[model samples]
Target: MAGSTPNDQPTTTPEIPDHVLRVHRRLVEAGHRSLLAGGAVRDHLLGLPPKDFDLATSAIPEVVDALFEKTVLVGAQFGVVRIIEPEGEVEVATFRADIGIADGRRPETVRFTDEKEDALRRDFTINGMFWDIDAEQVVDHVGGRKDLQLKIIRAIGEPRERFQEDRLRMMRAIRFSTILQFPIEPETWDAVVAEAKFIDDVSGERIRDELERIIMSPHRLAGYHLLSDSGLMQCILPEIEQMRDVMQPPQFHPEGDVFVHTGLVLSHLSEPSFTLAMGALLHDVGKPGTFEDAEDRIRFHGHDELGATISEQICDRLRLSRQQTERIVYLVRRHLVFMNLPQMRIARRYRVFEEDGFEELLELCRVDCLGSHADMSLYETCLGMWNEWKERAPSRDPLIQGRDLIQMGMTPGPEIGSMLEALEDARRESEVVDRDAAIAWVQARLDGRQ
Candidate 1:
């Protein structure tokens, strides 16, 4: 009777997954109360397809294991289990109340409890409601429905206490506000500012994950502003914070300071990849330190090179993969090279496009232009060249190899590599189009050295 769907129908019926419905039915038939909970319920109510289904119930861990055919004790000690089915995996957590949070991340202990106690222990109100599959209603014990209606993100209870329980909640609050396009309740936002520094207590990996989600979200610029406004940026990414107030030449960057320029560039990204997003965010990171009030105009001499070094350090701190670090660093280093495109010879342009992640580099340049002066002249030229190049036959295979140099009576050493590089350059420029021509060119250079 406790799990039975109410006879009356609700205005909006959640498109519950068939597998989830089966599991819910099974648990109910077994006399254990079960309800769909957490983000699934929130998303459903908002008319978005739920990401995943999580079940909360009165049944304890052991009883849940007995009722389900395939059960994984993912967090058994904490009253959580994973029920795997052909359709999908549903995380089933027992109703429990958190006791104490000693580490600022997890509760030191938890006690099994009823629905109200469980709902009260959650971080945000909108994430605290449950959908009663049996009752055809949303069971809101913490005013979650009211908050949802107002499009506000409010902590479940005392804001400070909730944040103190998990310092990462500060970032989560910002993320939810950005993603949902909802404003944080004033008190909750104030708590975020007050507890911003404590966010350092969270692990770098967790913080990085949260930041990545914010970067990938459609409202990334909003998230960026919230992070800055909340003071979390200073604690987690002071490099970015330092960009604040750093002036760029107005002629080149009509977008105010480096920080404003960076935000505008980020906003213009179309289908951002993580590396490209990070590169755009930190492209001019060195401007603050390199800022110079020159006689002619503002100058950030060598900012690109300095920014690359700084970006690598930041990547290391965030524990990004070696590959990701290298690509991001490449972007930062080469972002300025596009200005030299017109001066470069055809071979030089080919070499530039041959480098790894050249497409992303071009994309960063386009956004950088759009964000600043709205000039696309250079971007259009480069794109035209790239398109024309793509239509041509692929660059022919190198006409010579290191082994060829050795066979040509050259010593197997650094000079061999040097010769090969010179030959390739010639080949790229079409000066040497055949194997015999490549050999003849190399011989001529050697004879000249003599």
Candidate 2:
């Protein structure tokens, strides 16, 4: 069966990339039924440019290996072979019906089957369809086309049974539903909520990836709500879930609780990067634990520092890259520093702009303000400082070295480094113009200390 694009334009066999098409054609001409399968077929009908064009074929791994000049057995046991063409790589997987999945990660055993059976064994209906390239039709044994048209995310078979095969599919369901802005079919939604606890059985890295996808999506607010509603948030990231209903100082955060503030921060962000989004999401992660009813008002006195530590742990648990963890943690810890930046000295304030992830910090600061109090006064002051610094763009390097301080009667120990820092600050403040002036300034500083 063939369907139409979102615009109701009649759609036929999906047109894959030329390199991938050659592989499909070769597999079909070899008497094996090869079809463009999975996301490529689904996206074609949705009038969107698909990311990858993977193929499914009736040919076994051995047959696929023999047919291609340059082939790689990516997953032979599962009947998947990679055909390396001149233009690109195509993964031509043999139709497989998985058996028992004891680990909930992969099939314990698989039986090579036809396209229809393979489609039926897939996780979701929207991803179970295939396009018969030569026949110019779709092979949808699971009613995937209809479900796609209905704007729904439904499992191929029994929703629970499908989820039981791979627990990560539960998160994936939310990811797909959130990204596509589609509602999960009733049975699928029920199964997800019921089996939410099983998500822990999935590896931390797997959960991290899915969670990253959700948080990084433009519809992250909706995804966050879905995760909380589906109970996955409690299992995967209880640290964040704890933020719910944590009250803040009404004078500063009249918007609502910590959870509401977080959602507002995330929603206000536009096209945020992974680090920025993660930074925004976990910026206040410490508020729940640090919440205190002080004599004056609600106070999360050291929430920034605590949140940074917690953010690091969460990032480490998720197996995030070391660099990204460092940056996100930096954002979390220093998020509140801008509140007092305007009061700092010229060099003291401008030096912050020179550090790594400063721009993102500035953006995070803006979004933070947008989420809370709508007070951009401090953010604007910092922005003006940043702009002034950019226009001047003073030397990031120090005007003088430790040796210069040593020559000015400063000892070789910690004071030399301090003097060098002071020298850079003076240079940034235009208090010291050149090497001569820097030397004099350091000499004067030593004289004053003495």
Candidate 3:
């Protein structure tokens, strides 16, 4: 049933290029009925480039194996096979209807069925539609094409029953809303809010992966809003929700409460690396713990250090890699270093800049300050001073190495290590240049200490 228009102008159906269409044609020519399915069709209709193409066919796993030169019957019992081709590989699954998902995951038994039966069991309405490559018409038994046009995300059947089969779909609804920038239909949203607690049945790794995508979305704020409204935030990330009413001082954080401040920072974020984003989110988590009100003003004493500890535990629980955990924790702990900038000398400034990934730390600082004050003067001042230092006295290797100190009548011990570090600091500060000047500076320090 190809689409028709008056005057035979050939209503242009978006063409699937020869390469991909040929793959489907090969399967059909082998006497197997096939249709392009899932995200590829959804993306095509949305005018977005699809990441991968998937297919559903009436061909049994054995027939699929014989037709393609390369195929893997990894889940043959469930009617799925991986078809390999020179250009790309696509997943071709025989139409399946699932049964008995009592554990909130995995179908107890999968029965081979017609395409219509398979479509009925899918999670969302829009993702249930399929495209007929030969007829050039979409097969929409679930009114999915209409839902897509309406920009609605609705469950396929009784929302509660669909969600009961896989609890993770609750979060997936939030993710789709964020990714597609579409509204979750009222009934669907209410069902999600009611069943949000079932998300605990899902694995932490799966939950973390979905949460990361939500945070990275362009509409992160909206996603978070949905997460809270649907009660998913309380189950997944209660620490964030705790910031809601916790107030900060009026002088520095005139923006509002801790949650408001955090949201503002998130909104300003522009595709930062994952570690940076996580760090930014958790940077002030310890503020609530360290909050104190007294005579002069409010204070979150040592919150930077405290937040680092909290971040470590959270990252570990979430199973982050050691290096990733360390980087995020470092950012959280050292975020307040810029506040001490006025007291630090040029040498101290050089030391701070010399730390690993110092530029990213500076950017984190920018986000921190702006979220509270919307004032970047301090950040800009530091950047300007750093640039000035680089221009006037570019960094270089110290003229005096540890070996030089050892040769200069200094024993090879802790004293020599200390002298070598002091010499490097002097060089960074332009206080000393050559070996002679370094020796003189070290001697002055040692003699003064004595």
Candidate 4:
């Protein structure tokens, strides 16, 4: 619902994009009441640059389409239309009161109504405010202005009823709280905890999208903690919950438990890629399952190998793409390689360098060390070696092709692949520098085999 605040004024006027203003003006001129709504108004009040502008209007979807030169009926059935202009697109939703939410996601029926009814149906107070484009004033039908001032995320109406209407709002509340560095109102937070389990009822794609936003946020650690506290993490990622009291070898990890260590690592990540962040969170996921208490010391003998398998399963459950899953799994599997850096042979080192996503693997190792013992000796050594490898241009074109081997009267079989792999390993280590040398080396191996 869009209305003008009678007494309040914007501290700093936000530069409304041209397209949004045009749409609002056109709608108003056509005898429809239109105003900037939702997050755009919230952002403007906060003096932060808004990402996108959305308009709430008395005009129905058909009128919006008729008024705009180009319009997309993005959600026409729900009284939403996108006005496309040369500058950008603005979403204009007709003011409506939702009747029922049988699906727990969208309204089964919406009644076109005035601003107050529309404002009452929104999720949170901070998101329900509007800015009257014509009057140059702020609207606060749901006490949104006060909530924004207090830095609190409060549900617009009965918290339980609002959450029951849309389970994803539970995740969204956490996201907004963390991203804005605000606290959820006591009642709202309580309701979130009460309804956290219902989050699993939402689609995996929606869950994944929300999870990605939380993980990618600058305050991701805070978001993770909120998820855990609110019980949402248990429903979405129960494996992470299992890490709570999983003991680590104290000598190596003075940071208490696996969960604490992961949280610490997450804190150290500065401008992390999504894969790197997920890797940090799940790197030690195998420790809880493989914990061994021996007289010698605590040991997670093959946690890296097992963690990779677990990561793949998690990725598959989350419906991540094959490429994303592989990269994340690769990071989990190879996070421990830094420990072997000094002992690795030239061929092994070359092979490590040639693997995809080596940079991110190193970053994960660095943060992992930081989170644990804070001893960066291995990380530093690996980084230095990686730099040297980069300076030397370590990667080289294959000295010989499989077709060349087939052309040389050798039978095409598993032996061909084996021979090629061995030759490539030698070439990576600079044992053979040219095609002729590679041929001779293969011939010598074949001769020895004979």
Best by lDDT: 1
Clash count, predicted structure 4 = 1
Question: In candidate 3, which residue pairs clash?
Answer: none
Provide the global lDDT of candidate 2 against the true structure.
Answer: 0.88
lDDT of 4 by residue, 229-270 (tens): 999999988988999988888899999999989988987888
Q: Clashing pairs in model 2?
A: none
Better of 1 and 3 by TM-score: 1
Best by the TM-score measure: 2
Q: Residues 1-450, candidate 3, lDDT per residue (tens digit)?
A: 123234312244546656567668988998888998887777767767666678899988888888878877878887889877777777889998988885786788888899999999888987897888888777777877777778889999989888998888888899999989899999999999899988889887778788788888877878878888899988877777887877888888999988888877777777877788788888888888888886888888998898899899878766788888998899999988888875798778888878876777888888888888878888888888777776776556667777776665678889887777767777877888776887788767656752
Compared with the true structure, the alpha-carbon lDDT of candidate 4 equals 0.88
Model 1 score (lDDT): 0.89
Runs of candidate 1 with Cα error greater than 4 angstroms are 1-10, 86-88, 393-399, 433-450
lDDT of each: 0.89, 0.88, 0.81, 0.88
TM-score, candidate 3, is 0.88
Could you tell me which residue pairs clash in candidate 4?
A: 5-138
Sorted by lDDT, highest first, which candidate order results?
1, 2, 4, 3
Indicate whether candidate 3 or candidate 4 has the larger lDDT: 4
lDDT of 1 by residue, 35-152 (tens): 8999987887676788878899999999999998898999887899999999889889999998898799889888999999999999999899999998889888998777777889
